[model samples]
Target: MKRVEGRVALVTGAAQGIGLAVAQRLKEEGAIVVMSDLNAAALQEAARRLDADAIVQDVASEQGWIDTMRSIREAHGALHILVNNAGIEGDPSAPKDPQGAPLTDWNKIFTVNSAGVFLACKHAITLMSESGGGSIVNVSSIASLVPTPFLTAYGAAKASVQHLTQSVALHCATSGYRIRCNSVHPGQARTPMLEALFERMARQAGASVEQFTAAFVAQIPMGSLQEPEDVANLVLFLASDEARYITGQAIACDGGYVLAH
Candidate 1:
């Protein structure tokens, strides 16, 4: 049988980037996927690409989780996997401290990145328990493990996600629920978000984008940056029966960036 044959999965932020890659990987492993994002047009486009059901939702809202679960129940009857991948990098506002970051920026990052994962897990666990258990993969970041200078809020939020995953996993295990929870930490991948950051860094350093990218890559012991699929492959493994024994762990797909740096 296929790795995830007959399974149903819900992936948040599935319109693009890491989420999109995870959804595709899950589908390839034989799971029926349902994806959601705040970007309606992008979600629709991603849906078309995967031929999967897609919903537009603001993941930061409590009602959005309720509605998303309701839709999944009505459409698929039961869900076997939940991938909490929705997050924001916060607004480009000034820092509040000597570094110049703003409080509003921190709030925005926490709301979507940390609180959103909490809400999704809150609802998903309820449903998963009823169905006799499921697997959850919370997409965190390498920032959670290492110190990130400018993106303090983002790092903190992802760190919360890692802790939350462990908390949920321990709860389920102790409470006799079969559900499993884990977090995946990805490093700088070649997504639009990374591109934007690279552009900024390139301009700041008076270098071309390629030059800045090479400089960044030089820090990784692996001598390269990771691709979205690099993270997706790990997610796919976690969602599969092969990972039935794994839970409450934070796996990093950073191409040695954490260690090298």
Candidate 2:
């Protein structure tokens, strides 16, 4: 049998990028994937391609989470995997440093990047426990593990996600729940979000995106941008039975970017 055969998985931010890749990977491993995203059009297209279920969701809202969980329970009866991949990088035009970043921007970033994960974990844990256990894979960022002086809000928010994952893992483990929670830190992946950032920075520097991308890749030890599939592969492992013994860990799939930096 395929890994995770017959399991039900919910992958957020499934419209594109890493989220889409993860959903695809899970389906390939024999999972019944339910994808969710704020972009209904893109999500529906992706879902139709995979022939998987899709839901419109805004991870930052409490009501959204409740409705989503209710829908999942009603449709699937149980959720075996919850991948919290929805997040934002904050406004590139806004001051990214702590001293200059607007409070509104900071709050906005936290609401989606960190608080969203927290809310997802909170709801997923209760349902997973009732369903006899499950796995949660939170998408963090390598910026959280290092000093992200240029993107303070994004880095800090992802750091909170990492910390929250650990807390949820320990709580479930000690409570005798079979649930597992872990965070995946990706470094310099070529995603829509990252590409947008690069474009903005490139314009500011009067240079092409390729020039900016190459300069950025030079900083990574692997000398290449991490592909969404690379991170999705690691997420697939974490969401599978093979990682039953692993929980509350922050695993980096950064192409050695974290080590060299």
Candidate 3:
């Protein structure tokens, strides 16, 4: 039997990159996938290509979470898997350190990255408990594990996600909801977001993008950047029955980058 056949799964930020990869993997595993993204145009096209459902959603809005849950309840009546992959890295051009980054950037990053995951977990747990429980895989970052002097706000927000994920997991486990929540920490993924960050950082350092990328890869013990599908594979495992015993943990899919870093 397919791992998640007949299961209803929702992936946020599914327009591209890791989100898109996770959506595709779930669909391939026989899940009934619902893809959501703030970018309506890209989401529609991606959903069309995957023959999946799409919801244009802003993850940072409380009303958006309410509407999203309502839509899921109406459409599927059950949500077996939720991938909270929506997040922002803040303005790359701005200073990102604690001493230099603006309060506005910090607020915006936390609103979306931290608070967004919290809201998603809040609403999802309710429906999931009502619909027979589910799994939540929050896409955090390696930034949460280590210091991020150049991306302070983003790191702090992701650390919030990590903590909240554990709290939610424990809450459901104790409440007999059967819901599992965990966070996945990815490192230096080769996504459009990372590419943009690399370009900006390279320019800031007056170095070629290739040189910057090479320096990054050199830090990774595996000597390469991870692809979106790499992280998606781990998510698939967690979302499936195979990881039924696993909960309240933060796993990294960084090709050993976290280890060396």
Candidate 4:
């Protein structure tokens, strides 16, 4: 059976990795998918691959969210699912820098990672609330739960996201919005983003990618990194009616990374 058939869904940062996987999965389940990302080339490529709508948007920009929702309202009439997946690590090399994190880095990271989700929720909630409500899944990270001094800014920002998820969920539930808000915390997933991350971490540690990956994988009790589909499946489940009773919770897609560590 189709889980979310005929639903109009929107996914941000859908050009690749987890966002792309969620978009693809939703479409496969018969939802009309709309994807947004700042990268024109990658977004275009992924849109073609999924035969889904593409909107170039900067999630941190309030105006961008406004315009995006306006366009969605015009094109799709209503939005049934919203995946706030647009986020950035913004130079994970802070551990190598003796000066620590700069103010600009902190602002940029939180703006896109934390405030972006807030902005999306602010606008999308109105749309969903007026149209019988829907589900919202924020793509957070296990770093939020695990203490990562190397990823100090990212961890802090995502922790804020986790708290924000609970607040949004509770508000919507109490206000009778019928909207479900949740955060999905992914572990080290196998994606281009993971490759870039390992490359940076290896450079910082003065080790090869193979050595770095081996050490990282050994840390996870599951013995491997998570795949994009692994994260996508959980997201799809949460978005579908099967999870109608679940909200205001942070679910992990990590392959036991947070549990082991």
- Cα RMSD for candidate 1? 1.4
The per-residue C-alpha lDDT of model 4 at residue 156 equals 87
Question: Over the stretch 174-228, how does candidate 4's per-residue lDDT look in tens digits?
Answer: 9999999999999988888889889988987899999999999998988988889
Q: For residues 156-190, what per-residue lDDT tens digits would candidate 3 score against the true structure? A: 99999999999999999999999999999999888
Pairs that collide, model 2: none
TM-score of each: 0.96, 0.98, 0.99, 0.97
Native-vs-model 1 lDDT?
Answer: 0.89
What is the overall TM-score of model 2 with all chains considered together?
0.98
| Candidate 1 lDDT for residue 38 | 96
- Whole-model Cα lDDT of every candidate shown, in order: 0.89, 0.92, 0.94, 0.91
Report the error of model 1 at residue 55, Å: 1.1
Runs with alpha carbons beyond 4 Å of true place in candidate 4: 92-99
lDDT of 2 at 133: 94
Residues 1-261, candidate 2, lDDT per residue (tens digit)? 578898999999999999999999999999999999999999999999999999999999999999999998999899999999999988777988879999999999999999999999888887888888989999999989999877899999999999999999999999998999999999988799999989988887799999998888898887788889999999999999999999999999998888987
For model 3, state the Cα shift of residue 33 in Å: 0.6
Highest TM-score among the candidates is held by which one? 3
